[model samples]
Target: MTATAATEHVASWYAATANPAPERPALTGEIDCDVCVVGAGFTGISSALHLAEQGLSVVVLEAARVGFGASGRNGGQIVNGYSRDMDVIEAKYGARTARALGDMAFEGNRIIRRRIEQYGIACDLRDGNLFAACNARQLKGLRDHKALWERYGNRELELLEGEALRREVNSARYLGGLVDHSGGHLHPLNLVLGEAAAVESLGGRIFEQSPVTEVSHGEPVRLRTPQGVVRAARVVMAGNAYLQGVLPALEDRSMPCGTQIITTEPLGEELARELIPNDKAVEDCNYLLDYYRLTADNRLLYGGGVNYGGDDPADIEAVVRPKMLRTFPRLAGVGVDHAWSGTFLMTLNRLPQFGVINGNVYYAQGYSGHGVTCTHLAGRLIAEVMHGQGERFDAFAGIPHLPFPGGRLLRVPLSALGAWYYATRDRLGI
Candidate 1:
């Protein structure tokens, strides 16, 4: 679906339970700054915060409210690393480059923990994340994943199987699981809102309801909105899949895919703990995966199901509730209190697309389904490159991403068919 009304957040459990914050005014007149960031989600806010911390003047503009896109409506699991794991990076871009990228794989998690402590952001910040396996093949992959990650100095891990795995989730769905001490889950919207407050405290500015209609790329980049124009020496296109038409070049390289989530009515503390006894964020190893976790208030926030073409399922609640039940039959009669869908960019290779456009215009997109922590990393990389510390930034930008091959008309159907094939494979446990 299109962005919700600018004045309010979309219908979501996060919106209902969100902490209070002052509403930011929309851009209404011409303004100039050292840098202008489009989209006030994680990337924009994080970029603004990073730049402002350096004492640079930064302005952020958003189509709707802060974290109104995938940033707000995600499953809230901060799974470490990229959509494509490090092994794929090594195969595609050699060991040396993969090693360099690997160093920063978990850096975003550190950035998040630091922000929570430094700013005292109350996001229900927790520790540890679980990667569950659906079958023996995926179980072996998790075993290998533990080894691969340990090689990168990430040694805080626990492998669980048989009764241990079932005890952790209290479900028979998973064959095994890998728990990463560094990864965790939290109130995603609150995290972004707190970061936005921190950004303002650091002297950065943010504008809501100020969607850019045009971007004139020149020496002093001009971003034109209906009510205002922001001119800056540098511009960042961080809108990801939600960005439409402002820059056709970046839009062509990423496809907007929809994912749905449902939050069950408060299950009392005992039931909640029983569902996830350790209370770690859990995601399975299927290609089309289901992720769920207990909220601070003890609700089961479960999310899965993807629409590759960015179309909303006719009944989002209907589409997702069954999936939740299938995973936890004990919750057969649990009433779903909230349901919502949001979009994220998908790339051909399932890797994030990071690069520059016309030299001064920077863009990052297509995180597939792995954007939570990566968006913060994207902000850091953007800040690094803007200051000429391009090594780490280039490590990602150096990787290439092809445009959606089927073009405007056929990409949706083409990608959907491919997704079906892979999802079939996942279902068959092949």
Candidate 2:
């Protein structure tokens, strides 16, 4: 199976404001390395940086550009923990596994901060994230969530209610909220581009516009791109939803879901703070959630609404603008400057799928909306495994995942049905 080149970044507000990255040449000849990683998104770049730091020769191939996928076009919130949360992991994978996974949950944010400081990556980093609850039940859930996370060793949290909550968000929509001081947001594309530069500084190679077309099993696994081939002792597939059909097994274990984001014209400093008083990123508590934050230029970037079949909405603003208006009615007439969509891989259980294939082939996907931070943690784990340290990698790999049911013929419809059920539950204030 061959993966196709995306050719360019999606038309997003991020692209317009991104720090200029030098155009890199495509891979045109065969090369050998200690490790060959496919996909130059967060996971692949993070892994490449770590592997290079470990003194391993590394090369990364991207079907498009680095951060071209979800890594570049996401809500930007540094959400704490996995998408499934620690309680779910504890129930499904046992306490031991959950503890290990929990320990690493907040490390991604640390890694981001460390790298930003060490390499002087100017990505407009922020300091907090807010989880708002629409109803009383949801408020109680936030209270419970704070307690749960506290028990899991995440103590940098505060619960707010009534006026406190309203003051936090400057909106009457939420009855209460849970603020994680450890959680925040940043410029997604610039973060990845900076990491790519850091990887190059460490002698790691990255090939843009090079899509893998084949993977053959052998002592040195062989990977083929259109104009180049890579023969490495090990191969890692970190392409996520953008991997296309190159690897059937990974495709089977995950489904691509498209989500949209719309950025309004810059609100200026005063208006921006008037919308979100403290400038914290926020995501509401709902099955179909809406997440938003103020960009460095003061634009309100709001995103949500999922398409299970992975089809981009004909008009991104038509799908997302209403959600943004509903959240901040004061911005009803605000002009949207850019709109775009990106695909993310989701598993049945909403946990990331990590494991080995063909012995030396390692792949991790299905972050299920938690890709931002989890990808960094995953990269470190993969690099560690390559260096004869597999404890952390084994913990995540041991988790089980259910493949999409009914295959391609009915998996999407089935998933949509499930989504409808949960969305209804959310509407009813459950």
Best by lDDT: 2
TM-score result, candidate 2: 0.98
What digit string (tens of lDDT, one per residue) describes model 2 on residues 1-430?
1354467888898898899897888899889999999998999999999999989999998887889999999989899888887888899889999999888888988888888999889889999999999888898899889988998789899999888876668877888899999999999999999999999999999998888888888989988888999999999899998776778866777899999999999899998998888889999998889999999999999999889978998888999988888888999878999999998988888989899987799988899998898899889999988888999999989988877899877889999898899889877887
Backbone clashes under 3 angstroms, per model? 0, 0
Model 1 residue 366 CA deviation in Å? 1.4
Clashing pairs in 2: none
Worst 10 residues of 2 by lDDT: 1-10
**Model 2 per-residue lDDT at 237:** 93
**lDDT (tens digit, per residue) of candidate 1 on 276-374:** 998999988877788899999999999997898788888888888887887789999889999889889898888888888889999887889999898
**Stretches of candidate 2 exceeding 4 Å from the true structure:** 1-5
Q: After superposition, how far is residue 223 of candidate 1 from its true place, in Å?
A: 1.1
